[model samples]
Target: MKPFNTGHEELVHDVAYDFYGRRIATCSSDTTVKVFDRNDSTGEWDLSDSWKAHDASIIKVCWANPEFGKVLATCSHDSTIKVWEENIREKQNSGKRWKRVATITDHKGPIYDLAFSPSHCGLKLASISTDGQFKIHEALDPNAIGSWTNIFETNTLSSAPSRQLQSSFCLSWGKSRFSKEYVVACALEQSYIYQRQENGKYTQTGQLPAHGSIIRDISWAPSIGRGYQLIATACKDGFVRIFKIEEPVTEGGNLQVSLINQFDDHKGDVWRVSWNLTGTILSSAGDDGRVRLWKSTYNKEFQCVGIVSAEQKHDAIED
Candidate 1:
């Protein structure tokens, strides 16, 4: 497959595939979003709609579950998250078909990343920012996309920063249907896991403990019927590490986390880490412009299975 150029005026920040992988959404420094549709008739992707999305560079874009219709959540350097929904009522202009439904102005600084919650959790979106904070917003009324409420917000670090910092803040939701409400967010060099309580609030539960450098990205693997939870992190120190968080014996108990493995094969800052649908394969992308795949053997040890060029978390703190 050849590389198809995304026609944006500035550098593209992020590219996200919709729920079914049939539609592609891209956000760019040009402060706009363009949707590409896979042309079933031609077996090629075509730019179907493009629209100005934010006041500043749009850094990340994500699609909601199909149960919510064609909805998109975008965050930007403008310090806000805007929700967009496709207007399907006999629309004539393709560009104007996607309308902004909610403008969330609850963050203090640039929002770097955002992810929608698992489908069972309803339409909740989690976001992390350079301000050292993470927030979760929910759509109260599915029909009225504009009805968004801030359900949870907390600083990633134990204390507020004394001054502004240059950090690649990011967050990932727990990707398991059977797990309790939880999210893992990272700020500078540390990452912490937060779990919701019975009283409608979230509290810090555990921490990932194997990094001396800042984290650039994070991904929580899907559990399915697995017994444990896995999280992969891309670190600025040129290593990719996976941690295992064992399920607690009781609800509201402390989660046990230990570093599973660390790979320095990238030899440069790793910027992205993701897991396959079954959580069996792990992929890491680094500053060296290479994507390496890691798969677990029958004995449960990870080995590099493949490497490709250019593909694919957060800050954590401790007491």
Candidate 2:
């Protein structure tokens, strides 16, 4: 990937690709969202569009649906999550572009992360905030306007004393191939997964000590006829551990989870770990500003396939 700078005076916190992967979206501390397009023939990236998006640093962004290439979502330290949709062709010709479609303000503190469920209905959204709360929302009417409804809220304050001290930070969702429901994983003091029940409520399915320090990111593996697949979580302690949930049928009919593997390579905090579309390869980025691509094979260890640096240059400014 080529580095396409926007000439902004701040650092970019998050970036993503549109549905077609032809266009890229990035949010920065400068409170602007920029879009770039990849030139097919030349294999070079070019800046196409940009806009002032938030009042503070945009922390994260995710595509609602890449197929339509219509909508995108972003979260910020401004304590809001905003959705933006592209305008029609005619409007774009007249200098009109993407506009804010929705702004969710239920968060009391800065929103750190967000995820759109892969179920395709855009009915469910999961968000986590610095206030140590993870919220789950559902659409009141699937096809109606302003259909979102808050259904579940988990807070460190209301949880047990042991959990109350654990701070909630990262959030992720996994679609169950066995069912239409999606599972939400929140990384915090302890890592846990909540599965959607048939009755429409989310229930805790598994819990584990994610890391020595705060868990930065957690991803669940896709099911391939196995009970429930594994989850990989990154930690500030510089370790990545993989855990698998075991639902072996006991005489009493019970389910259990087991720890599979843990790998320690980085000396600093591991900030993020993402699985590819196929779920076979994993990518991790951290405080060291180095991205490492890992593959699952031979041993339980991760083999770095690629690395990207975010190093800064120290030099005198030109007038």
The residue-by-residue lDDT of candidate 2 on 252-286, one tens digit each, is 22236667766666668887787776677777777
lDDT string for model 1 (196-234, tens) is: 787978888998884878899999999877899999999
Q: For each candidate, what TM-score against the reference? A: 0.92, 0.82
In candidate 2, stretches whose alpha carbon ends up further than 4 angstroms from where it belongs are 67-69, 90-96, 120-122, 140-146, 157-168, 224-227, 247-255, 287-289, 298-319
Which stretch of 10 consecutive residues in model 1 shows the poorest summed lDDT? 310-319
Model 1: runs farther than 4 Å from truth? 89-93, 158-165, 310-319
Candidate with maximal TM-score: 1
Best by lDDT: 1
Lowest summed lDDT over 10 consecutive residues: which window, candidate 2? Answer: 310-319
Q: Write out the backbone clash pairs for model 2.
A: 19-66
